[model samples]
Every structure is written in C-alpha cells, then in structure tokens.
Target: MRTAYSVETVRAAERELIARLPEGALMQRAAAGLAAVCAGLLRKVYGARVVLLVGPGDNGGDALYAGARLARRGAGVTAVAMDPERIHEGGLRALLAAGGRLADGVPARADLVLDGLVGIGGRGGLRPAAAALVERIPAGAVVVAVDLPSGVDADTGEVAGAAVRADVTVTFGAYKPGLLIDPGASRAGAVRLVDIGLSLPEPEVEALQDAEVGALLPVPTASSDKYRRGVVGVVAGSAQYPGAAVLAVSGALRGGAGAVRYVGPAVDAVLARYPETLIGRGRVQAWVIGPGLGTGRAAEVAEVLADPVPVLVDADGLRGLDPAVLRGRPAPTLLTPHAGEAAALLGVSREEVEAARLTSVRALAAKYGAVALLKGSTTLVSAAGGPVRVNPTGTPWLATAGSGDVLSGLTGSLLAAGLDAVDAASVGAYLHGLAARRAASGAPLLAQHIAESLPEAWRQHP
Candidate 1:
C-alpha cells in the first residue's frame, strides 16, 4: 500500500531521521534526488535555462543546492529569491560557487522553474511576492515544486489561496495527504517521492496498491462451490430509471460474486442485460440496496433491511434512513454516498460535506452503526470503529456520470463475496478506478466502458 501521512506525522518522522543524520546530510540527499530529476526533465541539461523560486525555509535550501548541481552540469541556473533575508546562506554560497546566478524575475524564456516557495510548514496561501513570481512563469514551462506547492494545505488538502501550479512535485520522505487529495492534488501535477529514511507509523491515510488489491480479491479454490463462493442480492432501480439496474448489475456481475439475485421493479431490464442473474431474490449472503431506487421505494428497501444479511446502501436509499433501523442489526451494513447525498443525510450543505469529508463520513458511519463509503475524487471508506481508508487511484475522467451506481454494485458484490464492509468498499473503489483508467487510455470514456473493462483489470491483477 502507498501510505500518506499528515503534515504533522511527516514532520515528526523527518525530525527523527534528521536528528540521527549528520548536519545537512538529509537535505543533501533530498537535493541530489531533486537535481537528478530536474536534469532528466529537460530535453538537454547542457546549457538549459532553469529558474528557481526560492523562499526562506529548507525547501528553498533544497532547490538552491539542486540548482548548484545543475550549474555544475552546464545548465544556466538562476534563483529568484522571494525572501532575501531568510534565504539559505549555505545553499546560496554553493550555487554561486557552481556558477549559478541570481535573477530578480523570470529569466528570458527558461526551460523549467523550480518552486521552492514553501513546504509542509506553510499555513496559508503564498505571500504576494511568491504568488507574483509564480504568476510570472510562462505557460508550458515545466514547474517543479520541492516538498509541496506554495499555497496548498499539507494536512487537509485545502488550497488557502493562490497556489503554485506545478508540472511536477518532488516531495521528501513519505507522501503527504495534500499530494494525494484534491485541490492540492490538482496543483501537484505529478508527484515523486524522495525517500529520506523516515520510518513512518501506520499512515493516517492509505491508497491501495495493485498487489494489495490482488491479495484482497476473492479467488475461488477447487473445493469452493457456487454457494460457498458467495451470493449478492440487489434491491435497486425503479420503473422511472430502470437503466440504473442495468448499470449496477453490470458492476455486480464484474465483481467476484458467484451469483447475483436482483429484486426490484427493474428486474426485467436487469434480466434483459444479464440473463444469467438469478431472477427472484430469496436468501443471499449480502444485500445491496438503493442506486436507482426512488426515495418513494421505501417498502422494497425495508423488506431487504429486515434480513440478517450484510447490506450495502447507496443513492436514494440514503434518504430517510432511520438510525433505529440499523440499531443492533446482526449483520454489517455499508452506506455509500456522494457529497450531495451525504449532505442530505447530515443536514448540511454539500460544500460542508466535501470540505471535511473525513469527519463527515466517520460521523455518518458512527451515527448509523455501519460502514460508510463517501465517494468522490478521494473516496473515503470509514467503518464504525476507526482507521478510515482513503482511496487514491482515480482520474477526473472517473467523475463522469453513473460512476457511483457502478461503485455501489461493485462494493455490494465484494461484501457478498465475504469481505467486510471496509474491505469491500476499498477493494471496489480500487477496481473501479483501475477499470476507468484502462477504459479511458488517453481518451474520454463512458460509464459503460468503465464497467466493461473490469475483466481486463482483473486479468492484470494476477
């Protein structure tokens, strides 16, 4: 798993490592890794013009040292000091010794700009001087940030104000939450971590790796029969939007469920698409409700919820959810909701739900005594106990409509296949993102295309 730490956690780890190392050794390691990457970025390192946006802290120090390395390699490097008083004295001296020059503004058409304006310690947006320098950089110039971009919140992934939008970001130690989540993630064009020998604790957040997913996936053995493999029952779709049934069933079929028993008014439509699906729902290992089911379709949902099977709820099923309904339930329940739907349940605005996604999802799960999957760019899966799972594999292309419906089906299928609520949601999200990436492959793709690519994604796993 690719784990991400909060700014505080990373800083603590950095402090521990730095304390053990020789004075400036850790920074040198960071600089060396950064300089190598900068050299590889340019078409030709020899005589390429490079601009460094230098601030006051160690972040600026890293860039200056990197610039000195580039200068020695025949690159014309210039440093635009945002904080003249606080500049790294040792780094500046080293750069000057290596023939790197100091410039007031943007060099005449530089090949690349290194953003050393701020690091994880920065609180708000960039200062006016730093922001001005960032704005002065010409379009298409490859901007590389040291540690993190200037204006992004390292802990919460919130952009305080005007932030440096980098083409690439070279972060030190382990991954920061800002680099993996949105707003901040949008600013960090592409992220590369430079390990500085920090042994992090169990990460505050984690992104599932392919190997993790492969291991988590339900692979039936020779002794496993259809009944033992697991069965998933779906209570979704209404006459109004029967296509939702088709899409959800598509996701369920792609999951490792041995059999799917669908129960809803859209049963005919689902049967039309997936004829192999069991027609009527009797006893199932797991139950998935909502998706296309209208808010008015409470009767059908109540019937399923009465059963002892683990339940995965989504979409309209989120509306009018009585906390009492889930109280003391023998089986597990997973509730998946996008921000808008989550907002409804929380009695708050969608903006509020999104702004504090981690807190909101955890709150909902605890309130209902069920696992909650708050789906978005960084899909959050929180259980009733603790230790939330944050999904990291996703593209903006996955934001296309109908994706959530598919995710609900996939999560339900995983739950049916005998994974717990947390595992089901996390595994489902990982597969959903991988499928979308495979489907898009450099072009726009529809939701149906993403669902169709699940088999290809599974094949890539083992």
Candidate 2:
C-alpha cells in the first residue's frame, strides 16, 4: 500500500530520526534525494540552468544544499532568497562555497525552477515575495517542488491562496495528504517520495496497492457456479436516459458478478447493449440502484432498495433517500457520491465536502449506516466505524461524464460477487482508475473507452 502521513506524523517521525542521527544527517539525506530528482527532471546534469526559490526555513536549506550539488555537477544554479536573513546559514555557505550564484532578481530564462518557498511548517498562503517568485516563472520552465509547493496546506490539501504549480513534486519521508487530494493535489503534478530515514508507524491515511487490490477482487474458484458466485440486480436508467443503463451494465458485465439482472424502463436498452443480461430479476445477491433513475422515481428505487441484499446507491438514488429507510436496512449499503451529491446528503456546500473529504466520506457512511465512496481526485471509501481506503490511481481524464455510473455498477457487481462493501468499493475503484489510465495514455478519453479498457486493466495482474 502507498501510505501517506499527516504533517504531525511526519514531524514526529523526523524528530525520532533527528534524536538518533548525527547533526545534519537527515537534511543531507533529504538534499541528496532532492538533488537526484532535480537531475532527473532535467534529464541531464550538465549545462542545465536551474533556479531555486529559497525561503527561510529548513525547506530553503534543502534547496540550497541541493543547488550546491547541481552546481558541482556543471548546472548553472542561482538562488533567489525570499528571506535572506533567515536562510539556512550552513546551506547558504555550502551553495556559495560550491560556486552557486545568488541573484537578487529572478532569472530571465531557466530550464527548471525549484519551489523551496514552503514546506510542511508553512501555514496559510504564500507571502508576497514567494508568491511573486511563483508568478514570475514563465511557461516551459519545469517546476520541481521541494517537500511541497509553497501555498498549499500540507495537512488538508487546501490551497488557501496562490500556490506554486510544479511539473514534479519531490516530497520527503512519506506522502502528504495534500499530494493525494485535490486543489493541492492538482498543483502537485506528479509526486515522488524520497525517504529520509524517518521510520513512521501505521499511517492514518493510505492508498491501496496492487496486491491489496488483487486480494480484494472477487475471484471465484472452479467449484463456483453462477448463483454460487453471486447475482447483481440493477435498477438504473429511465427511458429518458437509457445510456446510463447501458454503461452501468457494461461495467457490471465486466465486473466479477455471476449474472446481471436488470429492472427499469431502460431494460430494452440494457438488453440491446448486453444481450447476455437477464431482463427481469428473480433473486439477486446485491442491487445497484440509481444511475439514470430520476429523482422522483423513489417508489421504484425504494422497491429495489427494499431487497435484503447489499445495495449500492448512486446518482439520482442519492437524492430523496429516506433516512428512516436507510436506518432500518439490515443488509449492507454503499453510497457513491461526488462532491455535489455528498454536499446535498450532508446539507453542506460542495466546497465543504471538498475541504474535508476524508471526514465527509466517513461521516456520510456513519449517517446512512452504509459504506460511502466519495469520488474525486482521491476517491475515499469508508465503511462506518472502519478504516477508510483512499484510492490514488485515477487520472484527470477519468473526469469524463458517465465514469461515476460505471464505477457504481462495477462496485455493486463486486458486492454481488460476494465481496464485502469496503472490499468492493476499493477493488472497483482500483480497476476503474487503472482502466482510465490505460485507456487515456495521457490523452483525452471517453467514459465508454475507459469501460472498454477493463480487460487490459484486468490483465495487468494475474
């Protein structure tokens, strides 16, 4: 699993390492890693022009020491100190000793820029000088952030003000929550972890690994039969939006469910796309309700939800769900909601949901007595009173329309295939993201194209 540590946890781990090691050891390790990454960013060490946006804290120390390494390697290195007086004395000496230049003004042209303006110790937005430096770096200059970009909240993933945008972010110790979440995550670009000998305990937040996903996937043995595997009944899409049914069914068919049973106005459309699907449901192991089913179609929604099987409620089903009905359900239920829908369910704004994604997903699970998957840049899945699973594999390209519908169907199908709610959500999200990444190849891709890439996603593992 790719585990992320909070700033507090990282500080604690840093402290532990500091106490045991000799002076400057940890910073040297961090600087070495940072310098190595800087070299990789340029793709060559010699004749490269590199600029360091230095601040006062140890963050600036990291950059200065790293710049000294680059300077010795034949890169033209310049340090633009935002806080000259508070800069790391030792680091500054090292840079000057290595023939690195100090410039009061920003460089007119540079191959790469290093953002050392802020680290986990920083709070709120960037100071004016740092912000100005961030703004001055023109396009085409690859920005590499040391620890984190200047104006991002290291703990909450919130960009309180103007933040430095990086092409690649090299973070120390462990992954920070900001690197995994949106807004801050959006600014983080591609993240790389550099271990600084800080041994941390169990992380509070984590992303699932391939082995974890493989273990969680619903795999049936030779002894398994259709009914033995599990049946997934879907109540999705109306005549008005039949595509939801088709897409949902497409994912369900790809998922491990033994059979997919459809019951909705879009039954004809579902049959047309997936002729193998059973048109009318008899018995179902799990139910996936919502998708394109309209908000006012609660009566039909309620009937399917009434079934004593694990249910995944998404899209329109999220609207107007009876709390009493949710409170009384015996079987497991999983609610998949994006920020907007989560906001509606929590009686808060979308910004509120985005601000506290981890808290929001878990709170929604507790409120509804169901597993909740808050879909976004970092899809969070939480079962009430259980460990939250954060999925970090999705591409921005997965933001295409109808993607959520496919995710809901796939998750519900996993549940039908006999995995628990938490497992189903995590596994489905991993597959959905892997498929999108495979399909997109860094280019724009449609939801259907993502759905079509499921086989390649499955083939990635044994």
- Locate the minimum summed-lDDT window of 10 residues in model 1: 385-394
Per-residue lDDT value at 275 in model 2: 91
> Which parts of model 1 are misplaced by more than 4 Å?
323-327, 384-387
Number of the top TM-score candidate:
1
**Residues 127-236 of candidate 2: C-alpha lDDT, one tens digit per residue:** 88889888888578899999998898887677877889888999998998778777788899899999887888787667788888877777779999888888898889
Every candidate's lDDT: 0.86, 0.87
Error of 2 at 383 (Å): 3.1
Write one digit per residue (lDDT tens) for candidate 1, span 358-387: 678878888888888888888888877656
TM-score, per-candidate, Cα-based? 0.94, 0.92
Candidate 1 clash pair list: none
Task: Give candidate 1's error at residue 305 in angstroms.
Answer: 3.2
Residue 133, model 2: Cα distance from true site in angstroms: 1.2
